[model samples]
Target: MTDFAVAIRVYYEDTDFSGVVYHARYLHFFERGRTEALRACGVRHCELLQRAEPLVFAVRKMTVEWLAPARIDDLIEVRTRFVETRGARFLLEQEIRREGRLLARADVEAACMNRDGRPRRLPADVAGRLAARVRDETSRARSTGD
Candidate 1:
């Protein structure tokens, strides 16, 4: 799960009058990327919600940079990495690229919360799974001198 990527085609609706993607549209792409990345880790939102004590992830903070524009009809890949997982929160780094060229980047912090909207620590198993991904990626990077 080092860098899970989901390919997305820029649709006409995702762009503005000039055919360039609207700044806000990148957020949608990033969100989709994060969702898919979690799914790749075998963490599905529906499963979390179905637990006896339901939980959901909410974005707590995000910082983004729009390095370049993605125009309609372009095929872009959203790469997401789960960098850290703590008590009730996790951090993600994401990038939108077109053919290996960076287009935008975002750093996000997401909190796990109960249905009542109060923060709740991630289920132990869930946390362990995410932490394992971080560890695996780190060890691999070190071995490869990345």
Candidate 2:
């Protein structure tokens, strides 16, 4: 199981007039986290696109909780974990943290879709690799009692 962590700095453009990160910025952070996570697992999105079965993943649902405000210039870490993968969809748990404190959390459900935008099953090999990462992450969490 593989989990990925990406560090991002809140920029002035990511904030509102009050200098705090805007709500939408969290979604962007999560997107980057997911992309990096896949890359770390040796699954490049571009390569996926070039496959014979060429497919992409799209968010089916997202539930987010804002715990604290993040200000511009703050170094934030986006942690992404593949929580589950089944059938035609996968669930991801992502969080935004600053100095070990969770600033926001999101539960995302994503579906694999073909170029025509219809739901598709993930290739067996791809799913197996993703499942391995999920299992590893779960084991690490259990070991840490988290």
TM-score of 2: 0.95
Please state the error at residue 73 of candidate 2 in Å: 0.7
Candidates in order have lDDT scores of 0.93, 0.90
Q: Give the range of the ten consecutive residues with the poorest summed lDDT in model 2.
A: 1-10
Colliding residue pairs in candidate 1: none
List the RMSD of every prediction in angstroms: 1.2, 1.6
* Candidate achieving the largest TM-score: 1
User: What's the lDDT for candidate 2?
Assistant: 0.90
Q: What does candidate 2 score in Cα RMSD to the true structure? A: 1.6
Q: How accurate is candidate 1 locally (lDDT)?
A: 0.93
Model 2 agreement with the true structure over 1-146: per-residue lDDT tens digits: 22889999999999999999999989999999998988887778898799987989899999999999999999999999999999889899999999999999999998999999999998887798789998999999999887
Best by lDDT: 1
